[model samples]
Target chain A: MDRLSEVSASLVGGFEYNCIIFFCTLVMAVPLGLVITFGSMSRFKPLKWVSKTFVWIIRGTPLMLQLFVVLYAPGLIFDIPIKSRMTAVLIAFVINYAAYFSEIYRGGIESIPKGQYEAGQVLGLTKPQVFFKVVLFQVIKRVIPAMGNEIITLVKDTSLARIIGVTEIIMCAERFTKQGLIWPLFSTGLFFLAFCGILTLLFGYIEKKLDYYKG
Target chain B: MSILEVNNIHKSFGKTKVLQGVDFTMERGEVLVILGSSGSGKTTLLRCLNFLETADKGKIFVDGRLIFDADNKQKPSRAEIRERQLNFGLVFQSFNLFPQYSALENVTLAPKLLAKERADFKRNKAAIYDEIEKNAIALLDDVGLKDKMNNYPCELSGGQQQRVSIARAMAQDPKILFFDEPTSALDPELTGEVLKIIRSLAAEHKTMVIVTHEIEFARNVADKIVFMSEGVIVEQGAPEEVIDHPKQERTRAFLNKLSK
Candidate 1:
């Protein structure tokens, strides 16, 4: 029982890495995704093509492969090694999720009727003003459900950071398998399940807060 | 000078010509109603005048200032376009209120945004916002929505939503207001409320260009009426001459069909 308690505490400590990656990726990716969405929807053909193609490339490949490339590519191709494993994990996760979020953002933004834009225009609003003032919140209300799904997936995807040696929760639990204790590895599931439960509740509360407006 | 002059406007979507050689003028405070059936380019004409769509060829002058001239090869800047668009207000067939904002917010949004451009906005923000809110409340009350000022568009009836949109347009205090089939989206029983607001606006001597199919309402409110067919004006004159006694065969046929 003492061994189990000690192993559980170690796993909890390792879980901090997962939480850090999740929050760091989210903070960077959400706004970056919006920027990419604007790029993909740009009226200028070259910028639109570049953004679309980049999104396609990121979404088509496996994120595990992206993790490998981000960790090793600089060293192999340019002879300048990445100094920190955590930085590589953050870079890979942020880029991967940003590509996913951008498509969801595009869907939400395009769902708005053209009349909304025309109404703003006829009221003498500049295009940027129309977007920020009239359309942005509507888009937020629409994209929330899809974003919730992606964010939950992101919490699980943080385990992938272990591939580049970031020592997330699962990896810390795996150390107990070497000591002939299997239950500690299985016990990590409780942490994930509880975390996801809390996230689900959080998303549900956010959705209700925005319920005053129908998207 | 005429309050508005459109000299030979033309617009096309690829090969489908929508507005071809359309010309008209309106005196200040004149209610000019454009009457036509579907696909008759009435809405497109209103869009062009409101700068929602660019005309292929035309010159639009409001109060003797040239707003749009396809003859000028230089494209106007964004600020210039916005400045020109401020001269007109457009109410859509579908009431496109920002669903997230309340009725008073909808009415005050544009005026508040425009107020931010004032030189003293930063120092006088509270006073300016209070004044704008006061005006918005007055406008909503004018449209008989004083009690429903806090309702969202989804919460309001279709007629009430349309009235809120009318109040929104009037908040801009535009020189010329354009309506594109305002009641077409409302139920027949509900249209009376919206039409009554417009009738009251006309009584206030507000200059308006309305594109509608309601013949009796047009006759009641229009100072001048322009009848359009196949992307061109078939006839235009006083409401009596056009609605009651149209001279052109096409106009006579259209009025005949509508009356039936």
Candidate 2:
């Protein structure tokens, strides 16, 4: 009983940290991802190559490696510690997820027909208006399924913060394992499964709402 | 004065030439039908008149304004060019309605976006909605799709989709409408329906430029017919003179081939 109470109390701050990371990633990654998509599609050679290379490198490496390097690299290279472990984890999450989200965005935008663009031009719409009014909604509709997969994956990837000593849900569960109380570690699965189930329902609702755009 | 003029317009794609020094002119309120074989630049010539495809070397004048003049080749200011573009509405071979919008919304999009009149967004919305409902229904009635206003383009058939496209263009109320092979994607029955609607529109004295292979439709509806070959206007006159009594050997051979 004492072990359960201790585990729960210790997790309060980590739960808050987890929520912060979740919200920040959603707010930052969507727009950052769009910008990265533009970079990948840029007519200029250098910008396209640089953006694609960054995405490839981030996607190739494991998130655990990224968390460690991000948390320690600033301190090691510049001799000025980043000071906040939470900030390092947040930065690493934003950068890693933005790359994945950008590829999804690019795929969605490219799937639309070239005729739609020509039709917009014929109607005397400027390039920006065409993107916002015509292309944006279609792209959003096409990408929702792919985006849902990434977001559900993101919920699990948040556990990678344990490597940086951020004390997220899994880390709180690990401490109980050291004390010979396996129940708390198993209890953590309840939190993860429940969260994932809610996310699945949320994404299913979104897919239903976008049903009008079915090809 | 000629309302629109094209002189010596030429266009080439990498290695294949599309329009080689094409020339023609149209009086105000004149309906000219363009007829030609498939790669003879009939569609390319129509696109050039609206500046949809820039000509490599030519002069095009709309209402005596030098919209494009290759010798001095000064593209007009953006506002000037938009003003000239407002004079015509173009309908494509494929129905290019924005699939995201409903049929009514598709019809009202251009006017709402341009916002040339109406005081505020509310007034504009009301006016546009009214305009779309009224003319959209009328256009659909004319083209025979009066019941499908709420449906998206994807929900309609190829023929019904083309009618919706015609209605969408008519909603803009431009002085001249251009149709590029509008019935090529439809079956004979659907083609008959669209052609019948176009004939009624012609009765209303709507000035138009149509590039089509439907010889009988052109003969019945076109005030003048221009026969093109190898990117140039080989012959042009009243439909009877050009289609029935051709002077050019190529025009006669082309007509005979289609007749067979």
Each model's lDDT comes to 0.93, 0.84
Candidate 2: deviation at residue B220, Å? 0.9
Off by over 4 Å in 1: none
Instruction: Compare the candidates by lDDT and give the number of the best one.
Output: 1
List, residue by residue over B1-260, the lDDT tens digit for candidate 1.
99999999999999999998999999998999999888999999998898888899989999999999988989899879888988999899998999999999999999999999999999999999999999999999999999999998989999999999999999999999999999999999999999999999999999999999999999999999999998999999999999888889989888888888
Runs in model 2 lying further than 4 Å from the true structure: A8-13, A76-80, B70-81, B116-141
Candidate 2 per-residue lDDT, tens place, A1-215, comes to 77557778876656666767887887899899999999999999999999999999999998889888888888899988888888999999999999999999999999988767767666766677789988889899899999999998888788788788888887887787887878777777777788889989998998898777445
Which 10-residue window in model 2 chain B sums to the lowest lDDT?
B115-124
Cand. 1: chain B TM-score: 0.98
Instruction: Identify the candidate with maximal DockQ.
Output: 1
Model 1: DockQ vs. true structure: 0.85
Q: For every model in order, what is the iRMS?
A: 1.0, 1.8
What's the lDDT for residue A69 in model 2?
A: 86
Candidate 2, residues B30-53: lDDT per residue as tens digits? 889999999999988878776677
Say which docking band candidate 2 falls in.
Answer: medium
